[model samples]
Target chain A: MSAMGDSGYRSLVDPEGGIVDRSIFVDDQIFNDEQEAVFTRAWLFVAHETQIPNPGDFFVSRMGTESVIVSRDRESKIHVFLNSCRHRGMKVCRYDEGNTTSFTCPYHAWQYGSDGRLLGVPQNLTLYPDLDKSQWPLVEVPQMENYKGSIWATWDADAPPFLDYLGDAKLHLDLTLDGRDGSEGGSEIIAGVHKWIIPCNWKFPAENFLGDTYHNISHESVDLIGIGPSAAAGQKGRRDADIAEYQHVWAAFEGGHGVHSALRPAELGYQPTFRDHPAVEEYYRKCFESREKRLGDAARLVPFVGTLFPNTSYHGGQPRALCVWHPHGPTSTEVWRFFLVDADAPDEVKELLRKYYMRYSGPAGMTEQDDMENWNYATAGSMGPVARRHPFNYQQSMHASSWEGPVAGQVSTQISEQNPRRYYEAWAAYMDGQSWDQIYSLGQQARGNGR
Target chain B: MNQLPRTSAFFALQAEVADVLSTEAHLLDDRQYNEWLDFLAEDIVYFVPMQRNVEVGTHAERETTREGKDMHWFEDDKWTLTKRVEQILTGVHWAEEPYSRVTHLTTNTQIVTAEPSVDDATIVEARSRFIVYQNRVEYEEYYFVGKRTDTLRRVDTEIGWELVRRDVTLDQNVLLAKNLTVFL
Candidate 1:
């Protein structure tokens, strides 16, 4: 099929000679293909063991097209399984979450233990003369792994090992999981999960976190967390006209992942006290002061923002959180946010974390709701024929691309089309059947480095 | 149910409690935030513990009868509540856009107590069933019905009761609609 005619996959480049793909957000067939090819095959995040700490505790979560139960058995070990019953395909556990030793399928009296073991089959001999009770346990997910207390599972039997898939992302994950001190232990999802749905492709939000800094400037006024609208008009009055310096931003990693730290520096009005805060201020200082001795001069200079490949994004610093963008359909996505706080942090610190969580991402949170509304509204506009006919532009700062680093990297100005360009580059590679390793290798090749 | 007060005293206290409750509800529904703030005591405690189904039996049975969970939905003093109101008035508080239209009905008022030590005022405990239906623009309306158990003490003048504490026990675990933008 032609690029435009293709349902699941298409290549879109801007008029100014850049690739731009819109099929990922519009085609239902493509959505179906992804449900099986991407979501089911990958080791998707379910729930942290901390969420269900005690025995018989369970939390219901969506794994792409399927509903799976993540629970703690009597042994206090975490287990993940298809929530459906072995007999009639009825959902065994109905509540969103609860504690129960055995789940009785309401259709019949067949009961299953927390470990996905078939405990009872109503009347084993009477119901079916030769029924084998041992063969009818609840269907468990193919593989379940708990790495650093965050539970993840995969449905595909032939998928690569979890650690190999994680690659360099594991280091970033550890940095996130292990609290700033990395001494008294790590942070926990203290406030529980804040879940809500938005009407947009899952990747749209994922790419936003990946590197789209344009929205920060274009949608500044509408952004609930952004600087006041008057700040936009008074650009000349500002001391540092270079938006980057005013924003306290940083981005770079071994993988395609990047996050802007504009909200974390002192000059940027937003992060004036970022250096004063005890948790990350010292970590930030140590990295900056003794760059060579600590994290390496190059690494020390780059303050972390969010993750890149696979999935998941972390907002470091106080009132920290992890945002997981889960695909719901071609045009709908559900975002589950887990606010983090150091397990040993003071009660007052936890309270501050709670206030921040509610302010930014909670059900009544300011910025999150606005983000959702804009994404949803944008999706609606894309559905229009004429609007979509005009390829969505990413042409801004196209000429600004410059080759840099050890490799000939397509470096754009910090606030340039770098994110969207890199995103499409990765998307084309992924759709064209390149493994994540191959894609990251290509990125490194373009930058003249070999991994 | 058995510990209800004497009919006459109970009726009088019930009448006073209902009047005070209606006035408070009017102030809230009418968006008289400042006026409503005056009705609450300085050290008021508001609680809304999670509700669960329990079977009637002995104390032992009740002990393990699902130690119903606790949710501090609004575990705040006056300051926090004041800030919340102020935020609602701010231009950026989008959750309240088109505002949450509410009709708070407080009925079935029955007094259960009268303190003797307090000279002019009365320490009357009352129960009133309440239902608040909120309508959010372009979205579905939400309904919340629950029992409002309140402890009321006489204000300085002894004319009416001032709510000392309000324990609102909601009947459902899962919220039935989108966001909850209004106070229960």
Candidate 2:
């Protein structure tokens, strides 16, 4: 970790155990290194299997600075290809999402099959008769796999297996994906992928998603504009109530992923009224059971686990999502999210899920907009050279961040900076060029018997 | 193709609509959000209908709902618009801060029809196409294409017709900018 500081990147450290210092969220050189060392090697989420349901269905996604096309082939197999065409470096597919048997690059009419195999190249029959077609196929991602129905691809061959990389975060991922499988298989993604770009470092949203319950009190408490039913109802009177609820997960997983479950304490024992539908009830029951089984008899039950690692973060069975944290430059990041629904579920269930996701996490959602405002103002204000000189502090409750294994106790408390500390800890490892194996070993040591 | 000369009543109605829209755009561009609220009619209805193309067979006989050609984008109302505006004034608005510069050039104003034999009150609709050139501090320019429909009435001696309704139908399905925070 000290070596990372030697690389001209200043490390903010606190001996008391909380976040000592972190400028990665605002630095330019660190952002450039992240594109190479982190994004280029880390497995990035592509799309869900349900998104490209049939042959020829395709959706474009970005992993760090590079763009890739994730599509399903004639065999219904998912393929990840660099969006650049083999002939002239033009984008083979222009549409954000569509169904196409073969993509013909507009630049030179070179066509490629859904499987990423080069199908046709204009004038190749005569001009490059000796050229091998097999060597010119779309550049396939080095590693691609599906965790449940969610798709992920990596550019680095040295990346670990998808499941192994997920580690403890895998349980939460399974809860989000497989938990729905308990009743009628599972759900599917609807027609649209809920996306919007917020003007902040992608890490800002990532950190907020991972842990930042303080914002609901700090920002939303003042501006009571209603974006949804819950928010509207909460703000209907003289003294408006903050429309955010929390249940925070206080743990870290292997692969550098971590979780935080935050929910309003008042909502405890608030059972769903319409559980008569067997399928719906079963799905909800499994969700509850999964949390209980995983958390055991902790005093407070966490409804979801916020997994923050690599480049993506989200919770299992939860309505919120945080992805990309995609960098626009040194100080700005474009954040995109998918508030998905299980396709196999009923329309009413989908509607409920949509409203839930839309209410708190979507672009226009209440909590989400509140977050964007603060992030925008903070990042925008921190841009001035004078402001950059100020070392942003995170030294709060570090020594008190006690844990039994990976799960930190008293994490749901609003003032805990433990999550940010954990985040920077893993970040420090990556900045120091620690191999994945070595990092995992260190993470296990950090978590003790949790692994 | 022969039509009567545009009348004084027509010009008055058109003038009202143009004034309302320009004022609205100014409020948005200048971020003078609080003042923008007074222009909207309390019962005003704002809708950007999602247009979709239905198959010719399903929508035969030259009906409007044909696939690949027809679509709807946003169908909103006064309530929704008010809420949208409120979010901005509250400082929680993320879409428009350091606001995107926008200039609404509304032209080709025409009075399509005027209800005849009506009392002092007259019902007339104005049609105009506008091009909104907008950009943030360091982003690419976004071209917003659409036609604005304003229902206006000439009241007493006001400088412009009093706007009762405004509807904008954008041609593009996907919003090019990061977010749509201003009126076109």
Shift of residue A423 alpha carbon in model 1, Å:
4.9
Q: What is the C-alpha lDDT of each candidate?
A: 0.59, 0.59
Q: TM-scores of all models?
A: 0.73, 0.75
lDDT of 1 at A49: 69
What value does the lDDT take at residue B55 in candidate 1?
Answer: 22
How much of the true A–B contact set does each candidate keep? 0.06, 0.12
Off by over 4 Å in 2: A1-23, A175-185, A194-197, A221-223, A231-247, A262-268, A271-307, A315-319, A344-366, A383-389, A405-415, A447-451, B1-16, B19-76, B85-105, B108-184
Per-residue lDDT of model 2, residues B18-97, tens digit only: 67566666766676655555555566655443222322353332222122222223334455566666655665444554
Off by over 4 Å in 1: A1-8, A12-33, A54-56, A74-76, A96-101, A126-135, A196-208, A211-258, A261-311, A326-335, A379-451, B19-21, B34-74, B98-131, B137-178
lDDT per residue (tens digit) for residues A318-393 in model 2: 4534355666666666655654555555666665455445434544444455566567667777777787667566
User: How many residue pairs clash in each candidate at the backbone level?
Assistant: 12, 37
